[model samples]
Target: MNTAAWSRIARRHPSAFLLAVQLLSLMVYPLFDGLPGGRLVFGAFGATALVLAVWVVNRSPAVNWVAWSLAIPALLCAVSAAVFRNQALLVTASLLEALLYFYAAGALILYMMNDNRVTADELFAAGATFTLLAWGFAYLFVVCQVWYPGSFSGAVEPERARTWLELLFLSFTNLAAVGLGDVLPLRSEARVLVMLEQFAGVGYVAVVVSRLIGLTILRQGRDS
Candidate 1:
């Protein structure tokens, strides 16, 4: 496709593209991290995430400068950690990632709230932010595990893929308040964090839906 075509698609379906990239990374990480070119797969995931972050930064007028400033260093840290294979650097990269996603989520939420009429793009952005919340927590859980061993039960293997996928799964389940017995938080800190995530999940849904519905009804009233 030409540059114009790509630009049009991006403009029209920015959230869709962002959601696809994030979901793809989450799904592919565990499945392919065990195979060859694992580093490459990780690099690709980080690249796509960075691209989405840049897109959000450019699209958001008010926070674009802040987003750009933070995103550059986060992207650099991600690349550096992957290249150098430094454990400490990876932790830094992961923390940066969580922060960046939280920022992106805030920007998207701001856009959603400000618009008088909600569009598919806005709804998709909302969903993307929700998933990003889970993603951020996944990274946080990993950090917790790193800092305090046995923070979680049923985490047997030490492989990076296992660690990530397990935590990602746990994060989502906790966020959604749908816990399976496969993994459980053993540490007090982990339990407290999980409670916080659960609260966030419920509160986010309640607020976003109510805000969107209110906006829609107000717009309709004005139109009628």
Candidate 2:
């Protein structure tokens, strides 16, 4: 496609782009995660996702500058953490990333709830918001694990700190209200966070998703 075509698509479907990159990262992550020379690659992927998230936020009702402000420091911290392998930097990055994701999720939610008309982008935004919430909680889980070592226990390595993917799996399970898998939160703080995520997951479906579905049904009925 031409540049204009790509730009048009981006303008029309910013949320779709954000959702695509995030889902694509899930597949690409395992390939680079925990392997030699993985940090640099992972950092690149993270930076790309952050940029896309900022773009999506710009399309929302939220202040675009705020997203940029958060993303810049978060990107810097993420790169520094990945390159230096510094635990302190990693913690800071995770905290910043969690905040950024939460902010973006909120923006997308506002965009979706701003109007009754359920456009294609709004539908995509719904899915994107779900992923953003999952990522935010996963990053929070990372910080929680650092603050309280052995916060999570897994079937394979009961004593070791859970991997990023493992934490993400736990986050997804909690957010989707599915039963927890191998990774279990053992600490009070971790359990509390998990409970909050469970509520968020249920509430998203009950509120945002149901609203979208109802609106779509209403629109279809009017057309028919």
Candidate 3:
């Protein structure tokens, strides 16, 4: 094909990829509870990210090669998460996905850093919207279980109820990688999942935050 034809084929709209990401995320929200369904739910999350990566690799210009290289490992991690029935595997897969998303998010942010097509405020708003949407779905998953009864005890053998407050506290702890022992995961799967989340959480902070900090310091030095 001609060079012009190739260029046209490679430049897909970013919205197409983002929509795939959102659909995959929608599939993950319901599957957090300790059950067979939860496994499938999280599987979808990784799958969606994988699909987005593929689309990005095919379309994103000269950068497509680098994106493909990083995306291959990410998609493999997603496949591993999908195939493994172990709870730990699922959690690990998610942690990997979290890390992959961290990289993806950074790439997007850097792409927009100087572009006038979207304002920094607009980008921040978009990020917050996705975060809130994810949080809402996760909450609804728990509430629906409570509104109806669960296959397993919501809390534990002796405890009668599962509080959103407690779940939130643990979720943040997992995100922050500061595991306090009080809210331990009872199921083996949950434990595996938590460990993956913890690892991803720490690694993400280490990689992404440090990069952003360096960017800021460089910006300051340049300004001065």
Provide the overall lDDT of each model, using Cα atoms, as 2-decimal numbers: 0.77, 0.92, 0.47
- Please report, as a residue range, the 10-residue window in candidate 3 with the lowest summed lDDT: 128-137
lDDT (Cα, tens digit) per residue for candidate 1, span 15-82? 77888888888767877766757766877787677668658656654467776676677778778877
- What are the TM-scores, per candidate, against the unseen true structure? 0.85, 0.97, 0.42
- In terms of lDDT, model 1 sits at 0.77
Write candidate 3's Cα lDDT for 83-182 as tens digits: 6745444344444444444444445434434333443332332342233223322333243334444311333542554444355445556666564534
Backbone Cα, N, C clashes tallied per candidate:
0, 0, 1
lDDT, model 2, position 38: 80
lDDT of 1 at 97: 80
1-224: candidate 2 lDDT, tens digit per residue: 99999999999999999899888888888888778788788678778889989999998899999999889999999999988899999999899889999999999999999988999999999999999999999999999999999899999969999988899999998899878689999999999999999999999999999999999999999999
Ranking by lDDT: 2, 1, 3
Please identify which of the two predictions, 1 or 2, would achieve the higher lDDT against the true structure: 2
The CA lDDT at 156 in model 2 is 98
Q: Which regions of candidate 3 fall more than 4 Å away from where they truly are?
A: 1-13, 16-20, 31-38, 53-63, 86-95, 119-125, 128-224
Q: Cα RMSDs of all predictions? A: 3.0, 0.9, 10.5
